[model samples]
Target: MGDFKVLRLVTQGELSWEVETRYQQCYQLTRKTCKKIKDRVTVFQAPGGFLFDIFEIAEVKHWPDTDVSEFTSITEYVDKTLSGYFFDQELKSALKEKADFFTFGVDVFDVNNDKCFSHVELVATYDTKLGKVSCWTGKSYPTEDQKRDFINCPSLETHCQRLNGIRVLVLGCHDLNMFSPRSRASIAPGTSKEIVINQMQKLCDQFKPQVVLQHPHATDSANIWNAGWAGVRKFLPEVKTYSSAIHYFNTFGGEPRQPLTTVLNRTATRDVQNIVFTCFEDGGIDLV
Candidate 1:
């Protein structure tokens, strides 16, 4: 696990769907910490400090164990504890160039040999485009709703509405129905059930998400995908869908001039459907 290395500092903030403020902060932090992986280990200030899960970007291991003991403070963990022990030989210059744009709010971290490497950068000074400092570590961020995982369409819609302002975006993986590389070899009722449950749980836990909108067909049940009407009968049997809280809409077959509409607006405006919830080939959308 200690062998886990920083791949490269990915510079494409727009591609990562990060907010401009957070994006720029990540860029600055990367610049300050851009040392040849073999030269020195870098650390920075984690705004909320190490308590948040975002501190694991360093790819250290047994991270949860460290939370209880060691370090004078979260800042000390990065600047002193981990940084002090990190040998210059551990880093390789070739890999630093591969780092990508990341943020501290989403709390990106990785485990490596009882140590967790967190890419954190908190800004004490505020600049218009550079909000309260951030990071560029690569990790899954929350949806517009600030939710790591989602259970039903209502939750998905709720997330979308919250992202109306700013770069917050709502995206889905369409076309591919319930297929993950992790579950490729088997086919069973238990397998399908487990797959949905595991995916739902992990997404929520790691991402700490609100809505995880998935196609109804992705589930073991066949009746759920009838235009997303099923709405988590099995995945969330206890939850109730409040009519006032949910919005249902379709994203297909609109005028060429004005297509992709949601149920939020009655009129067919061009911007109304700009952000449609989906279930397609890729699902990497965010506010930026």
Candidate 2:
């Protein structure tokens, strides 16, 4: 489920969550300033209905603010309080299916020190509560540069067997973009694939890790959707790619709310309707 954050609630006054569909349309159009939340969710009630607790996904603050503090109806409030749990349950199911086949691991390291790799270790050991990912190995590292590079990038050399490993070296936002200039902006045609290719090769040479993952930011990806994933494909042709792959718990301040594509892939086409309807019943944002 998306993370839910409590926005302003009517303390002295009573505001029902119920509102007309037209009012909902108005809210949707005006939530731009209020959408900068973590869970990145919006709440809306069914047409000609009421909401109980008004719940807004933490990300709604990213949207343009239009006096969301003002309460319109009571049902909207109820919808906020109750719908979050419902959407959370549904989102859990959806993310589980999305992450099932990715088989990813993390290894974090302190950028300043050679001792603790926080990101890599966290990814490798942290278990997904939704059961989408397998259990963590809880592996520890003694050295700053741990090597195991042949998993994603194949190596024919006898010393480098293709082991299933996720080794990573954290680079700052500036350094990553230095390798791929296109990565500095939105991924587009003729982006410098070589920059990333070179970086991967250099990392492989230095660490000899089975696979290497990078943490690219919107600045590195030009704030484009899935820019990192796209950069992976464009830059590293030798590695395997997964369609509809999503970042694991990475924070992107309020990217547009894309419908759960991974869930739609596993479930039937008709199920999409149910999923979407459930999204609303679960966490659709509407103004009273």
Error of 2 at 256 (Å): 4.6
Clashes of 1: 50
Give the per-residue Cα lDDT of candidate 2 at 48.
Answer: 10
Name the best candidate (by lDDT): 2
lDDT of each: 0.24, 0.26
lDDT (tens digit, per residue) of candidate 1 on 3-82: 11112121111222233333334333333344422332111111111112233334222211222122113333443322
lDDT tens readout by residue for model 2, 5-31: 111110111212233332342233223
**TM-score of every model?**
0.22, 0.25
- 264 Cα displacement, candidate 1 (Å): 7.3
lDDT of 2: 0.26
